[model samples]
Target: MRGVARTTAFLVAAAFIPIIALAQTPAGFEFQITLSKQAAQRLASSGEGITVQASYYGEPKKGAEKHVDEMGQIYLGDERIDLPGKAATARINGSGFEQAAVKWLDGPAMVNVNIFSSRKAGPDNILSCDLIDGELQVVRKSRFAVHCALIEEGMQTELKP
Candidate 1:
């Protein structure tokens, strides 16, 4: 009788393995871009007159708690842009979403910022990133529109489990 009970328990556990694996879902977004030659030249000419800004938004899965976490970096001509010590970093929490926007001047000749969130705990969450936008100015005289596009939309997953 004991051997039969043990076999029955093993079968029951095995049956639920797939369900558990399918329950958890991964969530996040990635944004990347390549600057055009003209844009790069304009930035270089601007010298200490250029500025960059970035923002993000996200929603937590059902029954999951929310938290604030984000990271951003800029590169010009394939080289990392050095940020000033006084640069401001923003973080938002609660409200079922998160957002951050930072601005800095006198950056590199050409630049692109890659921003992404850290993994959150729980399932059924969704993350969406908007286009990063800003402006480029030369000696505070000429102003030009600057922006980044999503070269890749990122992986797709089912909306519902």
Candidate 2:
């Protein structure tokens, strides 16, 4: 039993020596891919049953801009309204959707999302909406708000058709 235990310990230590040696030597390489807001928007917009296109960083990205036939419905509160323009804006007409149009910018990524109005259900307020995969997701969080200063994780359109 002792011999077996010693052998196991020896094997484990020997196996780890190579890893420890490798850790001491640093392997460094620099590779980067850059995408602008328009490119990201175009990618996120191609989900299905939606038409979303964006031009950013002097480059434009396009995807399946076709509207998916069977998309989930979003129930935007009466207070939250989408404004028409290249720079989209959501206005909160009342407290119900007051925070819906907040925009948050983190590093190279910008997020725009709108919150649907909340309805008071028996005990809790319900903000109801199904986010269709390919539907346009506008970043409506406020940039000035706290905890919004870091680079955000964004979803890009898949390269596949």
Global lDDT of each candidate: 0.22, 0.20
User: Which digits, one per residue and each the tens of the lDDT, describe model 1 over residues 1-161?
Assistant: 11222111100101111222212311111122223333233333433121223222223323323232332232211112222111112111112111121122123222223322211222221222223322211111221221211123332211100
Query: Could you tell me the TM-score of candidate 2?
Result: 0.17
Q: What are the RMSDs of all candidates, in order?
A: 24.5, 24.5
Ten-residue segment with the worst summed lDDT in candidate 2?
7-16
Superposed model 2: Cα runs more than 4 Å off: 1-36, 39-78, 95-161
lDDT of 1 at 76: 14
| Residue-wise C-alpha lDDT for candidate 2, range 118-156, written one tens digit per residue | 222123211211121111122222111110000133322
lDDT of 1 at 108: 21
